[model samples]
Each structure stands twice: as structure tokens, then as C-alpha cells.
Target: MSASMPQKRYYRQRAHSNPMADHTFDYPVCPEEMDWSQLYPHFFSPMDERHDRDPDKGKHGVEFADVGCGYGGLLVELSRLFPEKLILGLEIRVKVSDYVQDRIKSLRAAEPGHYQNIACLRSNAMKYLPNFFTKGQGMVYTMTDVEEVHLWMVKHFTEHPLFCQVAEEDLVNDIIISRLGTCTEEGKKVQRNGGKNFLAVFRRVEDECK
Candidate 1:
């Protein structure tokens, strides 16, 4: 590895974190109050100057969120895949999140004008997803090696009124689906272990009541 690249050994953490634990996390009171410029500086302007400028000028919100993003493998890949879209990775582990942040910084330093659309934040997505994202926005992509977990996710998402599973035929054209199993660190580990991966993609649909 290059001297600038982050070493994975230095940022090791347990596989899972207790979401129920009382972890002190700073979150925005509301979505509008959140300052995204710090996360995606290339996409957004400073908060102070934003209000005075054109609403359409240098303003973009995170369109794709990788919840529990471990080591930011997907974020790096998606940066090259979707240079036009802003991607954010939310990881709860402090060391792991710091490693990802450093990794992005090194990559940006190594190659200028690249990897600016990607960023990582230390956040518990389960507790603060609503605080960062508004209702009826973005798609959810989930994959797991455990059959029980996969089934559980399928049951909950399929049962939800606002979320509908994307059809297999429809997923054929979406390049993001192809990377789910190949891009992430966990996915690479699963592949090395000769494990099977079950994937489900869901999109938000318009509510009839609205």
C-alpha cells in the first residue's frame, strides 16, 4: 500500500454495533438545517453564501446513501461510476469512519479533480436517517450473505406501503446492482469465503393519499 493510503489493520472494529445503546451523536435538528457543504464541498457552497446566491448554483444534496458503509469501498467505486451524483457513506464506528475519511483524502490528493463527490460521516443511520433525509426520496439497496436477514429485509420492505421491490427485468439496466456484490469490503469477503449473496432493490413510490 502507498504511504498515504489508509491501512485497514489500524481501523479494525467489531462486526456490529448496538443501535439501542445511548451513543452521543450530533445530528441536525431537521433536514433543512443540515449543512451538507462540509460533506460534499464540490457539490454545495458554504452555508453563509448559499442563501445569497442563486438557488440552483452549486447546490446538490446527497442522492445516494450507503448506510453502515464499512471501509467506504462502495463509496469509492460509486464515485467513479456516478461522478454526477453526490454519495455519502454513514458508518457508526469512529475508527472505521476516520479511516474512510483519510482514504478519500489521500485519493483526492493523489488524483486531483476526482473523488470529490464521495464522503463518509460517523453516524448511526438507524437513529438519524430521517434527520438527514426527507420523506419519499432515494432508493434502498440491500444485500446479505445470511438467508434469514435477507428474508427479513424482504418481508419488511415488501410489506411497507411506500416501498416496492424493483422488478428483475428493470434491474438489468441499473449498473449499481452489479456493483453491490463486487464493490463493498463485506461483499468481497463474502466472495472470498464462497458465500451466496441475496440482493433486493426497492424504490419509493408515490403515496395515493398525497
Candidate 2:
């Protein structure tokens, strides 16, 4: 059993077990029944303007997900860039998830019409990803929330049945429009320091998750 993240960050006696992850989760039977209104309030069609009460037709479901979102840096940036697209951050750590939620609330209060497309939830991504993302929901972002990315992290994601590893040829395949390894200042810093950040994208495929 993998032990919980310990006093390395802060002192806590949280019980975490890979096999016992489901004990911490209460998931929906289907994606449609999931309540997204609280997560993306700005996307909701005004009730005053609507004739019938069909939330599904009016609200846009989550298209982007960042598994293991730590401090929710990516969520904040993505929400600003794609205000129309709904994005979610799934963090398993209790205190970390609470911090992210508070972060979103502060951002929303500070600026009008911000962070409406983003929300953070506390849940084990390894165990409950299927609960949030429907089949073929789109690309799953796997940027490590940790300071140093790990080999185990890559292996965990690559092993999941829902995601098929996009090959290196796919980079030069001229099919995928949005490419990984962005050429920004952040990218340059990693490049200069010889950072071992593995660049890969995974497409969600149909699978029987037992």
C-alpha cells in the first residue's frame, strides 16, 4: 500500500491506500446526472430567458480535465484563456483541494466573470476519473502537480485503459492541431535546465472499466 504524502510538506496523518481509494468516493451512475451548474455558473442559460427547464441542453459539460491538480495553477490559466469551455481539476489531497477551492473563490470575487469555467474537486483521479469524464470527452492533461515529475506518474497514466498513448509520429503526423511542448518562456526554462518533463497527449477511448 502506498503511504500518504507525509510531513515532507506538512504534518498530517491522512490514511491513503491505492486499493482502498473507492471508500473516499461517492460517484454518479452516469455523466448526465452530474451537477455541473455549480462548477460553471457562467455557462448556464438564464432561466428568465428559457421556456422549458432542461439544464442539459443549456449547460455545457466539462471538456477538459487536469488530473491531480495540486495548487490549480493550470486551472486558473485555462479558465481565463477558454472562458466558454468548462474545465475541472481533480485533486485527491484534502487540504490541497480546499486550498484550490478557496483560490477559485478568491479569483472569482476579485474579478467579475472569472473562474466560472473552472472548479476543483477532491477525489482520487486514479480511481474515479471515469465518474467525471464521459467516453471520448477529449484530451486529458497530465501535467504533474508536483515540482519534479516522476516516472511512476507517467506509468500510471499510460497504463489506464481509457487513454491510448499518442505516438511520436503523431507529433509530425500533421493531424493534431494543438501540439504539446509549448515554446513559451516556461518551455524555454525547462529546455535550458534540461528538465525531464515528458511531453505526451492521450485520447480517451471506449473501455469497460470494471
Candidate 3:
């Protein structure tokens, strides 16, 4: 590994975190209150300089979010695959998220123009997801080695009024489906141990009541 690259051993953390636990985390009051420029500097200009550019120049926001993004594997890959789109990774564990942040910094330093579209934030996605995204603006992609957890996710998402399970046929052309199980660190560990992975994709749909 390069000297600048973050070593995984230095970022070790417990395997599980209680999403319901009270952990001190700083989050934006709303999506508009987020200072995204700090995370993705290339996507935004200084506040004073924004008026001189096209209205759309700095209007881009994170379109893809990887919840519990371990080691930022998917974030790096997504940055390459969707160079024009902004991606963010949310990890709850402090050291693990710090490792991802450092990893991104190293990647950006190694290749100046390539990795600017992706960033990692240390946030509990379970509680803060809504604070970062507006209604009808999120898609969920999930893969896990635990059957019970996978089933639970499927059941809840399928039962939800605003989310519908995406059919397999509809995702045939989507390259991201293939990466869901192959890109993350946990996924790789499961693969190495000969574990089976259950995958699901869901899209947020318009509520009829709206």
C-alpha cells in the first residue's frame, strides 16, 4: 500500500452498532442547511463566487447514498462509474468512518481530478436519512449475508406505502446491482467465507395521498 493510503488495521471497530442508541452526531437542520462544499469541494464554488456562475453550476447534491458504507469501497467505484454524479457514504462507527475519510483523501491526492465526486460522512443513517434527503428522492440497495436481516428489510420495504420492491427484470441493465455485493468490505468478507448473500432493490414511489 502507498504511504498515504489508510491501513485497515488502524481503523478497527466493533462489528455492530446500536442504531437506536443515543450517539452524539451533528446533522444539518435540513437538506438545504448542509454544507456539502466541505465534503465535495469540486462540486461547489465559494459562496461569494456562486453568483457569477450559472445557476446550476453548484446546484448538484448527493444523488446516491451508501448507508453503512464500510471502508468506502462502493463510494470509490461509484465515483469512477458516475463521474458526473455526486455520491456520499454514511458510516456510523467513528474510526471506520475516519478511515474512509482518510482513504478518500489519499485517493484524491493520488489522482487529482478523479475522486472529487465522492465523500464519506460519519452519520447514523437510520436516524438522519430524512434530514439529508427530501421526500421521494431516495433509492435503497441492500445486500447482506444474514438471512433474517435480509428478510426483515424486504418485509418492511415491501410493506411500506412509499417504497416498492424493484423487479429483477427492471434491474437487468443497471450495473449498480452487480456491484452491491461485490464492492463493499463486508460483502468481500462474506464471499471469502463462502457465505450466501441476499440482495434487494427498492425505489421510492409517489404516495397516492399526496
Candidate 4:
């Protein structure tokens, strides 16, 4: 009976053994094995410049998107300039992306509304831009309004999507050909020359939000 009791005890201990002990670990993080190429390719490369040709094509001044922002300098500037405008910076590289995130955090703490308008996200801006802004609906501000000295200190901006559509070349011609299109009336301007340049503002004919 004593021998049988000892065998029973051994079997009981083996039966109750931890199931996780025999399981194999998938992997351990190794510094040398890390694929940094897949992580931070853009960290060393110069960031591509993004030009939003038709700035007024999206939703009104509720949000602002800084596409392909490197180190988020422009985003920070926009935040300071327009505290009420919600700003988002998109970057692709892992290290730089993390850096921008930390910057926004610190800025938010230092100034009350300094970083309130800004944020950073790791993403491919080109691919995700459409996701953020609909066809005829995005935050847009008139260059004239932005250039206003009085509105510089104003925390909030009145939301208006309306603006005159003008090409940068036409603006130059308006200055040179007609002596700043000086003699010409508002609706009676002639096309003296044409070239591609930044489209400052365009009227939103239809509300995509509707």
C-alpha cells in the first residue's frame, strides 16, 4: 500500500505540471537583427514638399492638414499663427515620426494653446490625404485673411469657404502688364499671358458635405 501511495503521488504531480513550460518562445528582440531599412528610410532623405494647389477645396476652417511634413516646422508655425485651426502633421519615418510626436507633446505643455492646434501621425500623406478631406470639404483660409495683421492675435477664425480664384502668374501680370491690372475693371480683365503657378484660392461651388 505504501509503494502504491508513492506512485500515485508522483503521477498526480506530473499530471498537474504547467502547460506553458514546454511552449517555445517565438522570438527575442536582437539589435543586430533589427531591419532599420523597413523602419526609417525617410529619416535620412529630404522630405518632399507638398503644395495644396486649391487650398479652399475642402471643409471650412475646422481642421488643417500638413501633408508630408518633415520635423513638423510648418505645422508648428500654422498652430502659432492660427490657434483655433486644428493642425495635423503626417510623417512616414519611424524615428522622425516619434520626434514630431514628442515635439507636439512638449509644445502643448509649454504654451496653453501653442500645441492645441497641432498633432503628428505616422502615415503616408499622399495615400491618406483623400481620407481626411472630402472633394469639396476641407478647412481653407484666404491668403488675404492670413496676411491680415489684425487677425494675427485672434484665437478663432470665422469659417468661410468663399474666395476669388487666382493664379500666381496672373497676379504677376496684374502687377506688370496693366500696371497691377491697374486700369482694368474687376470683371473685365484680359489674358495677356498664361503659365502654371500656385492656385491661391478657388470658389467652392458645391458643398460635398451636403
Candidate 5:
């Protein structure tokens, strides 16, 4: 009699990948990298009641950002309103980014101060938000996804002790913050009349304090 041993078989599979993925664009880079003057040309004055701007300067600086700036229009207006605060616009599309870059160049040349406080960058906002924001370092401002940034703020602010110390009043006086498709119906109504054009408020609350 002879003893039999079990045989084991191994299988291997080829990798599934796309060649274009390697050269894909990363949106939402930091504010300092790109020049807004070469991206957005027209400046809309917020005080004129036609555009959007964070009127509370005593609360935050011009060091704000727009994570997914579609056309760089909002950033232009923001620059005019908060000339002291440095504004950053982050976009992913190569065509749009290039257009904004050129627009900003023309705007700056036409009116030097039109974009004096503005800049732009191209990167993925979701991945780089934490890196861009450092514990109450700057007055975080945006009109992008409310739920996304809200959660990010709550989490980031909790992790970073410096963020927890921000004053409520200071937050209130920070900016006229709002988002698209947030209150979709009401937002559209306002945008239609060119009155306010957006909804904004300052929310500086501690969700999980340590």
C-alpha cells in the first residue's frame, strides 16, 4: 500500500489598469501656487449687493480658498471685497484651469489690484484639504459641498486643537459663507433676482471637543 498526498494548484491573474490614469490631473492645490490674476479677469464688488464676499474682515483674513472653482468668477469678486485677505481658487480641468489662468492675467494687467489678493491652483481638494488647512491657521472659506466640508471641518477642527479655540463671534464675523445646491430651491430663487445671489453664515461650533 502507498500513501497519497493532496495536490495544490496555484492561479495567477493579470493586472487590470488604464494607461491614461497615470497622466490624470490632480485638482485643488494650495492657494500660493497659481496666480489668480492670470485666471480670472472681471472683479465683482460685493458691497454693490450683486456679488458675494465675506464682509467680516475683523474675523478672518483674505487667506481663504475655493476648492472647486468652476470659472474663477467668485474668487474675482472675493478679491475685490476682501482685498486684505488672500484668496485661492482650486480647479482640476486643464482647459478650465488654463482659461482661468489667462483670464486672471488679463484682469491683473487691466486693473492691478483687481486680483492683488487672489491666486489659483490645480489639485484634488478632497485629498489635500487637511494639508491646506492647519488647525485654525486661516479663516477657512468656501462655497462648495456643505456636507463634505462640514464633516471635514468637524473632523479636522477636532483633531487640531488650535481650531477648537476659535471664537464664535469671530466666526460670525468671518465670512458670508454659502454653497451651491445646498438649499437648492431657495438658492435658485435668490440667484434669479440677482439679490444676495447666495446664502452665507458663519458657523464655528465644536462637535467633539477634547
Candidate 6:
């Protein structure tokens, strides 16, 4: 995702949403105030109001997010492959979001650590990207499937010893510094006569480059 220098911008309000899976137009005034313990209680300790009130004490947060995640199929797939990465699915529909939450619970009960890193939440991702994700982790896409680019990236990342391919569980044995996204195509206005959405997956060495 290409981002221009930071500048103040105004966003229009979205007043309409599906009532079946209705959502409230609420968001954090700032990222620090957002409590992630509700999303992944097992991973982090309960919030201490004293610590939470301190501006310097931030709670544990998700490193990966699936915006507009429908039924959470992709997140379910990712849970097995990237078991150590904290992943969250954002769904606008209430019922759908609840289902994903339950799905994760069942999977965890069946096999404990298989799903400790996955979670889901109900929110309007298009409007509240910053509320749940930090600037470096939030990924928005503008292009569709580009196989040539994917192939080249895979080759480059694989050749680099710091990075490894994520094809099965236990993909990352060591503590990671940071990770990039899968081939993402959230924004593709003009498609190639007949093109499909894309997803990308890559991780870079931390402290290597900003």
C-alpha cells in the first residue's frame, strides 16, 4: 500500500448499514485508548484501570487484520498457517461477526494452541482502520491479482534468509521482528477485462529498513 505524507483529511459519515448484522458508528478517539483484551483475553492479562488510564501503558494489539471479513474463511485458514501471529477479523455484520467468534472458540477447544493467535470483531473497517490497527500494520489495497508480481516477491522473500514461506503450521520458529501482508486488492476500480481480487504475504527483517 502506497501512502502519501501524513496530512489532515476529513471523512464523510456512513449512516446506512445492514440492520440484519447492524453496527454502531463508534470508534476510538485515539489508538492507545482502544482495549484489545476484549478481543484476545487469553493472550493478554486483564486491564488494570490504573495502568489503562496512564497514557504510556498501551494494551496488547493485533498485528494482522481481515477487513470486511465475511464468515472468516480466510482467517480460519490463516490460523493454522500463522499460528503465532496475532490476527483479527473485522466484520460489519453483527451475526456474521458472532459466528466467527464462536468458530474460533470451537476450534480452540478442539486443539488448544492451534487458534491462540486468531480473533474477530464487529466494526466498520472502511471508516475505522486506525482504531484497530497501527499505521505500520494496517494494509489497504488498490490493485487486483498480479501473479507476476507475486511470483517475483515470493522468490525474493524466500531467497532472503530472514524471511520464509508460510505454507504450513510452525512456519515461524523464532520471534519475528515484523510482517507484511498477503496480496491484497481491497481497492481496484478499473479491472483488467476480467480480473479477480488478490492477496499477498511477506515478512521483512525488523530494524532493517523503515
Model 4, residue 57: C-alpha shift (Å): 21
- In model 3, residue pairs whose N, Cα or C atoms come closer than 3 Å (at least 3 residues apart or on different chains), thus clashing, are none
Question: TM-score order of candidates, best first?
Answer: 1, 3, 2, 6, 5, 4
Model 4 lDDT, residue 97, Cα:
55
lDDT by residue (tens digit), candidate 1, 119-161: 9988889889999988777778999999999999999999998
| Alpha carbon lDDT of each predicted model | 0.85, 0.61, 0.84, 0.42, 0.49, 0.56
Cα-lDDT of candidate 5: 0.49
Q: Which residue pairs in model 4 clash with each other?
A: 58-137, 58-138, 59-137, 59-138, 59-139, 174-180, 174-181
TM-score of 3: 0.91
Count clashes in each candidate, considering only residues at least 3 apart in sequence or on different chains.
0, 0, 0, 7, 16, 6
- List the pairs of residues colliding in candidate 2: none
**Under the 3 Å rule for N, CA and C atoms, how many clashes does model 4 have?**
7
43 Cα displacement, candidate 1 (Å): 2.2
Q: What is the lDDT of residue 48 in candidate 5?
A: 33
lDDT tens string, model 4, 1-210?
Answer: 011111222212121223233433222143223222221221112123222223432114226665545456666666666665556776655555566676666665565435555676666544445554445555332221123432432222323444334344545643222221222221122224432111243335353321
How many angstroms is residue 22 displaced in model 6 relative to the true structure, after the best TM-score fit? Answer: 8.5
**C-alpha RMSD for every candidate:** 2.9, 8.9, 3.0, 26.7, 19.3, 13.1
Predicted structure 5: clash tally: 16
Write candidate 5's Cα lDDT for 46-79 as tens digits: 3335333333431243356776664566776676
Q: Pairing residues by index, what is the TM-score of model 2?
A: 0.63
- Candidate 4 lDDT score relative to the true structure: 0.42
Q: Judged by lDDT relative to the true structure, which candidate is superior, 1 or 5?
A: 1
Q: Whose TM-score is greatest here?
A: 1
Residues 1-210, candidate 3: write the lDDT tens digits.
Answer: 333898999999898788888899999888876777778777776545543134564465788998899889999989999987889999999999999999999998888887888998889987898888876776778888999999999999999987888888788998998888888888889999999899888877762221
Per-residue lDDT tens digits of candidate 2, residues 78-116? Answer: 776777777788877777677778778777777766667
Select the stronger candidate by TM-score from 2 and 5. 2
Instruction: Assess the local accuracy of residue 16 in candidate 1 as a C-alpha lDDT between 0 and 100.
Output: 86
